[model samples]
Target: MNKVIEVQKLSISSSQGCIVEELSLSLEWGKPVTILGETGSGKSLLAQAIMGALPRGLEAKGEIRLLGKTVECKADIEELWGREVAMLPQEPWLSLDPIMPASKQISLVKRLVSLLNKPKSESIAIDSLARFGLEGSEGKVPSQLSGGMAQRLAYLCATSAGGRVLIADEPTKGLDSSRKQQLIQLLKEHSNKGALLTITHDVEVAKALGGEILVMKQGKVLETGCCESVLNAPKSEYARSLISARNLDHQRGDLLPNHKVLLELKGVEKSRGGKTLFSNVDLSLREGEVLGLVGDSGAGKSSLADVVLGLVQSDKGSVVHHQVLTRPKMLKLYQDPPASFCQSITLAKNLEDLCKLHQLDRKDIPRLMSELSLNSELLNRKPDSISGGELQRFAILRVLLMKPKVLVADEPTSRLDPIVAGSTIQLLLEQTSRINCAVVFISHDLELVKQVSHKVVKISDYVANHSSELSSPLVTV
Candidate 1:
């Protein structure tokens, strides 16, 4: 049969309301399908419902067919895992075993799901990682690898089972431009042998995949057609805005940062596992300025950010803040929102603790949530219960509540859709300007940094030596 996956009248609802309503679609082998939507627009809920992995308190109703055979609604889909279907998640590192070495994780999936012999699986795993430019990372655990490297390892594990159908949710989130195109090519190759369903906010990815496209908003499909039609000549206003956000430029930010220096790094040097990441780094961040940091995947951008925030110590040199800037007054927004919060506690409880610790007013949350487009109800749910985008916005709210003198935002808007991302960046600039907070904004998207940062630094420009196992640079633009 040509069809690998089909869903009819799929609906997902929670106590708050229906998240994904009456969605229907069909996927055929040798072709790919892409779903693009705003944050909290039910793209992820659909994927979970299809995989029979929806979180507790959510109910799904629909009929799913695998290889043209019908399955019960909300059926236990364990039998379909690996050999039938596999998923690459947004927070891929969360899916990987923290203690398992990179190569072993891939081999384990091959052995258990594809039923390959141990030696054969091991051989294939190493070869596969090399192809993905993870050759020297075989022994690295999830925590040891950079976010992009970890994401690549997770992808290897997901596809190792030879699943005929793949569901990739935000698969390219942490990748550099080159790595993103590489992964997209691999996904296209997978479609040649199976069916691929990609849920993402990146407009460029959907365009490159060149397949049927669906644009959803508020849990409803707003536009559907071939990629060219929906993206090029979109009938929906929101779709047009989404496409235009990619062309965002430097006009939105300050051209010169003349304010007082709030934080500075002097003769900084750091190395990991006998490999140098960056050295002799010097930079100054001024009040109300957005200092942008950009680099290829696996570069020491995050490490440098940690040094500035005092989360990590440098091997040589020092990080100093103005006397007014104290430990509690400097905060960092992590790359992964889920890892930043307590998974077992409700969002509200987390906020309550933050408020009590700082002796801040709880009334500020609602106003800030409104500014960030976060719903009041999300606070009642645990971190695991909310969508990635929603949780990311909540993370922003948390940082905004603190009103720090220095805010180290690591890819703050990476998880948001174009529409939401545009507004969110504007809000950050406005609020931070009002509070005179200096920001160290780390991102893989250099264009985004240019658009919103007062000054920019490319880590690649400062690298002493270049290799996959090591990369990092520091220079002030």
Candidate 2:
């Protein structure tokens, strides 16, 4: 069998030091491989290394061969990237042209491949959109589309290139189960035609692809073997912990006898462009309850959260709070935290500033930071200097400092790895529960929603049923 790509003792590093160390693997033309690991574990670094698109200030050593031809230079890797090997990035939005309409962007890709003329590209784009339950969204720009829709469009554009090897990094992130299944099928089709290297923290995605698994951590390979055998019976301690970490038991004690409804939405109606997003919807969050808001992309999940957060007003509705509404009384956790921060400021200064505004005690900062597994040194660093996972944890801690009665998290963990995200969620739950805060957890990750929520609300007609078998009894690391 002809090998599509081969890696021998690959080491990726930067001025600060190594990120991926002496990683080695091979991918055959007919087979697909999944790389699984925790956040900042070098899974994505490996993918970028193979594509020859490592971020600035980063370089690689050792050998990488594509189609049996050695790729030792940036020029060589660039030459083969789009033509022979394509990638679906982790943040699809970053890869897309913000100004371009989804259809036109895809059409442009088709034209580039010379597979069809401009006129024919529309039909292909429409068909692709329809497969992902986005039939009428072709004319929409990236901003107009929901995160999941944008991600689907990104997949269409990348795979549309017809490359011999596809490197998909977290392709299914932000997708509901139906859309996720469609993407899985699409990836399988691509794998049948060529080779696939998927970097994911999703176990179902790894198993659904039915290929070998490569587990990495802290830039090193911990284990690699057939998917079933390795995931089911991981020999490496880290791999076993990684696989078992996702399992969570949602059982909890009953709400305190004095638990009261902290926030309520009464007869809420929201509409945009003459279309009713949702109407006459009533919801409530009680003290210590983790309310899971489940729905498809663009089904008004985030809009509803916005209404509660006072970011967006409903066309006809009233937000009633059991107590006076104040800046320190309610908080919202966005999917992307760094974007919301004042990046120029150090982490400690940011927290101190927020404390000053809220008149909160700054003494708890160090203790809270320690509780979240955050390094005290990070407080001296600017927001851009830290990883997303760390920033996310910091964001959560920032919000928690106010001790809000109601916390609204909008897909807070969508961008994080499963292990890091899981731990973060656990911390969020523990901290919130300690304060008896009501949490509105918004996410497309059904398994995660189910794992942590006390009650789940479905806004749309259907909730995609995710595979429950993917998780087992979690072993504490």
lDDT of 1: 0.83
- Residue 55 in model 1: shift from native, Å? 1.6
Across 327-445, the per-residue lDDT of candidate 1 in tens digits comes to 77899888888867998999999999999999988888999999999889888999988889998888889988998889998888878998788788788878887788888888888
Q: Per-candidate RMSD vs. true structure?
A: 3.3, 5.3
lDDT of 2: 0.78
After superposing all C-alphas onto the true structure, candidate 1 shows an RMSD in angstroms of 3.3
For candidate 1, list the clashing residue pairs, or say none. Answer: none
In Å, residue 170's CA in model 2 sits off its true spot by 1.2
Per-residue accuracy of model 2 over 1-477 as CA lDDT, tens digit each: 488889999998877777788978999976899998777677776777777777666788999888777776667766566567889977665688889988888888778764687778878878877877777777788877767878888888887767779999988887888878988998888888889999887888899998899988777888899999998999999888878776465444356768888778887878754557777767777888887877887787877777887888888869888867675677888665654578889998998889988899888788878877777977887876565567778888888888987888877777566667766777788878888888888998777777787777766622232221112231110
Computed on alpha carbons, the lDDT of every model, listed in order, comes to 0.83, 0.78
Q: Which residue runs of candidate 2 sit more than 4 Å off their true CA positions?
A: 72-74, 112-117, 250-254, 272-275, 327-329, 336-369, 374-391, 415-418, 445-451, 461-477
Model number with the top TM-score = 1
Worst 10 residues of 1 by lDDT: 467-476
